[model samples]
Target: MASSVTKEISYEELKALVGKSQNLLLVDVRTKDEVDKGRISGSVNIPVDSVEAAFAMEPEAFKAKYGVTKPPLDAPELVFHCQMGKRGGTATNTACKLGYVNARNYAGAYKEWCEKEGK
Candidate 1:
């Protein structure tokens, strides 16, 4: 069945979610090089520039990398974050257009998370 898209959490809410053992799909839409500096725990690395490519990958390839089966155009819950809100917001929009039912943009992104969490 087709599912409805929704933003179930804000940046602060996402921080709480991070503390809990939730089955969340947290994506760091930053370059691999940038992620080498630091990143949120439990986040998958999918550079914003490569999201389209990643989504277009074969199911088995995508699953091997992301650990989830191919998500329908609108099936999984995705939380995208970048250095600042800009890239994350853009990534979120793209994912929504691609049919992610619950794609959220973490406005604070990594910078905010680092500042708040003192990382």
Candidate 2:
């Protein structure tokens, strides 16, 4: 695994990123059942269990299914989140291994987001 595979961001930093980056890709790496309870608005659904599968299969297939487009080095960041940030961090690491330079893990994932969003 690359050293840059893990990049964690605070909730405030995440909010700032969202505010500034229109092209940001916010991904929720949680189970379908968990997501049914509640999730951040506009976050793409990608179950954590399936991440390894995506990497095992064709990378482009995963990208297409998730609507992720390849961007230049200066492209907007890709933010991932999960129930408590563990899965999100894992996903971010995997994404980085697959060449996503701007992959970031939202440390205060759905749990913190929900509290802050007053859910």
Candidate 3:
């Protein structure tokens, strides 16, 4: 399925980015418990419920609210994912509306990640 966001990153691309970039902001939009099961390495949890508050706060406040540093308005990339794809897509759209043009969704999401790991 086509992602609503223009910059949808595939699982392969995301895996490469995780290894290559330390500054990339990877967010898991699943619930806390879903995340507790496991999340992509380097991804911070941002449960879809709190997306607005995370993006709308001041830099310092954003960091405290979401437990991740606020990427600059022109940040290069902010990647999001959920267990499947829906909530991550919602996050990508919300981030764009909040002026984070760099936000991208991991189209394959965490379900794909787990499946691949079991292979």
lDDT of 2 by residue, 52-118 (tens): 5664456477678877653443445678899998899888888777777787889889999888878
Number of the predicted model whose TM-score against the real structure is largest: 3
Poorest 10 consecutive residues of model 3 by lDDT?
A: 1-10
lDDT tens per residue, model 3, 2-116: 4455468898888788968977999999999998889898888988989888888898988777677999877887898999888888888888888887889987899999887
Q: Write the per-residue lDDT of candidate 1 for residues 1-119, one digit (tens) a residue.
A: 12334253566778777857455678899989999999999888888888877877888999998776666665445688889777777777778877676788887788888988888
Off by over 4 Å in 2: 1-4, 52-64, 67-74
Model 2 quality (TM-score):
0.78
Show the colliding residue pairs in model 2.
none
Candidate 3 local accuracy as lDDT? 0.85
Runs of candidate 1 with Cα error greater than 4 angstroms are 1-9, 19-21, 67-76
Instruction: Give the lDDT of residue 103 in candidate 3.
Output: 86
RMSD of each: 4.8, 3.4, 1.9
Error of 2 at 63 (Å): 6.3
lDDT, residue 80, candidate 2: 84
TM-score of each candidate? 0.81, 0.78, 0.90
| Top lDDT model | 3
Question: Each candidate's lDDT (Cα)?
Answer: 0.77, 0.78, 0.85
Clashing pairs in 3: none
